[model samples]
Target: MRKGADTMQRASDSRTKTIVVVTIGVLILLPAAYGFIEKLTLFILAVKRDLIAGFTIIPVVNYLIVTAGMACLLIWAVAHGMFRRIEQPKYTMLEREEEIDRLDASENRTGEDR
Candidate 1:
């Protein structure tokens, strides 16, 4: 029991450390990369003729990108929350009623020894 508790505690710490490292990497690295790319894009637009009227003239497209990004972020946040909330119980039991609902006696064998 103590060994199991120690292992679980170690696993929790590892998960938290991993999340912190990834969060820091994403939050800091992503914006820096985005800014660098955006600036480079602006530079390219300045040097090119077609870009003069690209997204600059269409405000909605930029807004769309922001909207899409926000939607994705919202989805990711929700999924992460759900995963954290249900982090326990690595295995699950399927009640026979539920399992039988998915089985066909003649077409498929219930594959479990009685």
Candidate 2:
């Protein structure tokens, strides 16, 4: 009886893992598949219309615009100190909290002495 229960639990766990993997795969692939299909459709339409030059130039322009935008964002982040001593802020916060607690404790001790 105990062996049968163990076998059933293992089967359930396997099924759950398979389902989770399938779900994650679908979530990741569905958007990528849709984008591919959309681009293919647009390329076919452009070819049909003989506007291949515009289609080619548009993708290049889009790539440039996206690159520039990302560069600007990165510059802004650096200018604002987003990447400066990333771990320092976390430790600083903890230290500040500890200092405040120490001050409060000292204040309480002084008050009791009076």
Candidate 3:
């Protein structure tokens, strides 16, 4: 009975944590997204009326294209699970380094014997 209660408590805690994180993210991201959208709308209107200079439009379009490309890349990475095992690469790198050190030590020992 105590174990079951503890499990329930843990589950509740996890849910609360997820809710808090999502709430905070929404609070932060929504405003920034709104601002960007507002600016984009104004920029589009300006371009439509040919109010913006050609040089200015070129840079703005380039920025939009790069932002879109990066957003797509981020989506692709998330879908491919690139962020799931964020620490796995560090361990793999350390393991490779250890293997290389061992091989070098063995080579040195053999050279000393010869």
Candidate 4:
């Protein structure tokens, strides 16, 4: 019975992880897909002379700006230890709350008994 429960828990955890990964992947890809479509549209317009030559550079500039911004954010996250032991924060928060609760309970007991 314990083995079966453990297996079920593992399966659930794996499914949850997969879903989270897929969601994050979709979120990351959506903007890139949109940008590709926009750039393609701009290129088509430029080729047909519907857009000015100078306007054709808009997509390139936008891509550069976005890429640079993402790079900066990645660097900042790394520097600030955002990616280091991602699970640590979750456990740390829980531990902190438990500690606070313990302290509060102790104080309450002392105050009530006095």
Candidate 5:
């Protein structure tokens, strides 16, 4: 029975670690992958160049960097929204305040607030 309980605890710990690692990996990789795909699509279409109408092709190479940056920002925003919905992050200011209040109340109860 003790062995079984220990095994169960270890399994639960392993599962939790897996979930945290996967969530972090997805958050980091999703944005990068999406940005790459969008940029590749833009290049393949060749429409952006025509739309910008030779403004991108300047002495300073401005359009290339700007377009790529915009694509990255767009992808990051989209992926961030998706991840936030799925992960339901726990670090809100209200939650933090509640936690602090609980800690303070407990300390006061124990006469440790002096």
Candidate 6:
């Protein structure tokens, strides 16, 4: 059926978009993550060998923890479909406002008639 075909096409498009997003995310994030990890490793080694103050590790560790937490939140949002329709909320709000305004006008007209 044409409907079935359209459904399949939509599903394929969704998959393609997801793949493209993930690929681009990886391309952008992978190198930065690798560089940060490398630096963190060096800092940790320096602290272990007493070449640097142990306190220096504090900031690095804190940064890593925060970054990981943020990354987890991003993944959670994506998995929960929060990113799927970023523009939809604005349109939905506008529609609801219009409906409410229409209802208010209708109520006002009825009240005037009574």
Query: Each prediction's TM-score against the native?
Result: 0.41, 0.44, 0.61, 0.48, 0.39, 0.72
As for TM-score, the candidate ahead, 1 or 6, is 6
Instruction: Please estimate how well model 5 matches the true structure, expressed as its whole-model Cα lDDT.
Output: 0.76
Give the Cα lDDT of each candidate: 0.72, 0.86, 0.91, 0.87, 0.76, 0.90
Q: Once superposed on the true structure, which residue ranges of model 2 sit more than 4 Å away at CA?
A: 51-114
Worst 10 residues of 4 by lDDT: 47-56
Q: What is the alpha-carbon lDDT of model 2 when measured against the actual structure? A: 0.86
What lDDT is obtained when candidate 3 is compared to the true structure? 0.91
- CA lDDT for candidate 1: 0.72
Give the alpha carbon lDDT tens digit for every residue of 1-114 in model 2: 999999999999989987998899799989988996798688667767886446586675687699789989999997998975679988999999999999999999999999
Residue range 35-54, candidate 6, lDDT tens digits: 97898788778888895488
Model 5 stretches with alpha carbons more than 4 Å out: 47-114
Q: How far is candidate 5 from the true structure (C-alpha RMSD, Å)?
A: 9.5
Give the per-residue lDDT digits (tens) of candidate 3, residues 1-114. 999999999999989987998899899999999999999898788778785444588888899999999999999998999977689999999999999999999999999999
Per-residue lDDT of candidate 4, residues 1-114 (tens digit)? 999999999999989987998899899999998998898787767767754575657787798799889989999997998876689989999999999999999999999998
Model 2, residue 20: displacement in angstroms?
A: 0.3
Superposed Cα deviation of residue 47, candidate 2 (Å)? 0.8
After superposition, which runs of candidate 3 have C-alpha atoms over 4 Å from their true positions? 1-21, 48-55, 98-114
RMSD of each: 7.1, 10.6, 4.8, 5.5, 9.5, 2.7
Ranked by TM-score from best down, the candidates are 6, 3, 4, 2, 1, 5
Candidate 3: residue 91 lDDT (0-100): 100
- The lDDT ranking, best first, is 3, 6, 4, 2, 5, 1
| Model 2, residue 89: C-alpha shift (Å) | 48
Cα deviation at 74, candidate 2, in Å, is 40
